[model samples]
Target: MKHYDYILVGAGLYSAVIAWHAKQAGKSCLVLERRSHIGGNIYCEEIEGINVHKYGAHIFHTSDRKVWDFVNSFVEFNRYTNSPVANYKGEIYNMPFNMNTFSRMWGISTPQEAKAIIDKQKSEITGEPKNLEEQAIALVGRDIYEKLVKGYTEKQWGRDCSELPSFIIKRLPVRFTYDNNYFNDLYQGIPIGGYNKLIDALFEGADIKTGVDFLAEKEKWMSMADKVVYTGAIDEYFEYCFGKLEYRTVRFETEVLDTDNYQGVAVVNYTDRETPYTRVIEHKHFEFGTQPKTVISKEYSTDWKEGMEPYYPVNNEKNQMLYQKYREKAQQQEKVFFGGRLGEYKYYDMDKVIASAMNGWEALHR
Candidate 1:
């Protein structure tokens, strides 16, 4: 039997990066992925010459220079800025609650005019905001909240604004400028070709085995390696000893349209309570593809259950306390290292995930 220095539980970005680093350090690694393929949630499928995001929309944006440079080394990225449009009952407006949105909402051009309306509406909530509804109104005023925030948030969480906690939406950014850029990060773009190129580069020298469940035969796999790097749900690793952590999962309905274009932009968010799905994404627009046919995916947020692909972690008071218990138990395992969104039980963007993986590698070496 072959012995290995490390056994990675998941072949996602976190594990891929660690595997790459281990190979460079003259160490042997065995990467076991539960999914049939690698790249985790960032995996994309090409249909009609277009790279469709299989899981959901993942735009790489980061303010960190080192992180940006690190990813660029693997694959080139296209200049695709995320300027999502929100459609409220067929009415279109720019995202991030910017000046373009205010102008269309109230037909006002100046920032002062927009500010006056928001300030007046915000004053209605005089006392501390009790729930998400009041909290949103206090932050960006009633008009923006009603049309853009209320229904969309409710649909995402599967709960009404009144019932949801205020902490979920601490603040809604209301930009006074005409810029429609969704992110404030310095570097923002999509990987050219697709995210698989980056994943392929990361897995160049690593021994990867897909469609294998490490947790099923934990003792057998652990015996092959000196240490284990787990990236799956921490709760599941312990067989739900402290109960499962709550997560919000999304379902995608994708189709190839005959027409070259469907929506002009990459993302169009349906911000009305009546709309069943939250957003419709045009995959071609993400890479500026000129394919004859276009592919689109309608995203619907649903309550997560066991055996489902978990997306957003619910970091509420109850779940947080439970995760901490799992964390304490995880720390006691001297031969194991927990990382990634599910492992850490925290939401992270693509760049942040890469940065985290690099940090984890450094920690292990030092």
Candidate 2:
């Protein structure tokens, strides 16, 4: 067997960056990806000349300058600001509970007018919020919560708001400005061509094998490298010794439409209970592409099962406690180092994932 300095598992963002840094340091790396494609969840498929976001809409946004510069070095990013709109039973409103949303909801213009209405509605929730329903009402008001928060949240978790823990929505962002920009991050955009370009550049010097399950042949892979960088699910890596951690995954139904445009925006969140899917994403709008045809994905948020791809971690108390037990066991593995969303069991943004990889690479040397 040809030995390598690092056996980077999962060719996701974390693994790709680690491979890049390892190659830079003149170290050999062997990358293994369980998925058929290289980009992991960030994988894009070209449909009708449009790069469709295979998983869901993954808009890269972050405040850290180092992380921003690192990705930009591989591929230049476009100025694609996420100004998503919410559709509640046919009524459209600007997202992030902005001034425009309040105006459309209450037919008011001034901040004072919107504030007064919200303050009055907030009075309904007197004591400490017992559930997500009360928490949202207390934060924004009943009108916004009922119209925007209620059905959408229920669909997301497959549970009524009253049954969910208050901490799930610790704080809801309410902006008085007319801005619809979702994230307050300093930098935001997608790769100029597509995300594949960035992934290819990052893993250019590495030896990668796709469609190989690292968990299935752990010993064989472990023998190939001095140290391992595992990015798969921590629980699965440990064979679910402490019981499986909860996660919320999404199902995407992608379609190549005949028309040039569909929703007119990159993202439109269906906030109504009747709408089965949470959001509709038009891939062309992400890069401002003037393609003759468009591709769209109807995103349906579902609870994680044994076979489904885990998208978001259900960071409830129970799951976190189980993860801690796994973490304790993971610490004892001297030859292995875990990183990324599934490894750390936290919902990490794209830039944060890169930052974690950068930090992990530095720690490897130490």
Which is the leading candidate under lDDT?
1
| Per-model TM-score on C-alpha atoms | 0.99, 0.99
Q: lDDT by residue for model 1 over 1-366, one digit each (tens)? A: 789999999988899889888988899999999999999998999899999999999999999999899889999999999999999999999998999999999999999999999999999998999999999999999999999999999999999999999999987888999999999999999999999999999888878899999989999999999999999999999999989899999999999999999999999999999999999999999999899999999999999998899999998999999999999999999899999999999999988898999999987766
Q: Clash pairs of candidate 2?
A: none
Name every residue pair that clashes in candidate 1: none
- Summarize candidate 2's per-residue lDDT along 1-366 as a digit string, tens digits: 899999999999999999999999999999999888898889889998898889898999999999999999899999999999999999999998989999999999999999999999999999999999999999999999999999999999999999999999988899999999999999999999899999999999899999999999899999999999999999999999889999999998988888999998999999999999999999999999999998999999998899899988998888889999999999999999999999999998899999999999998889
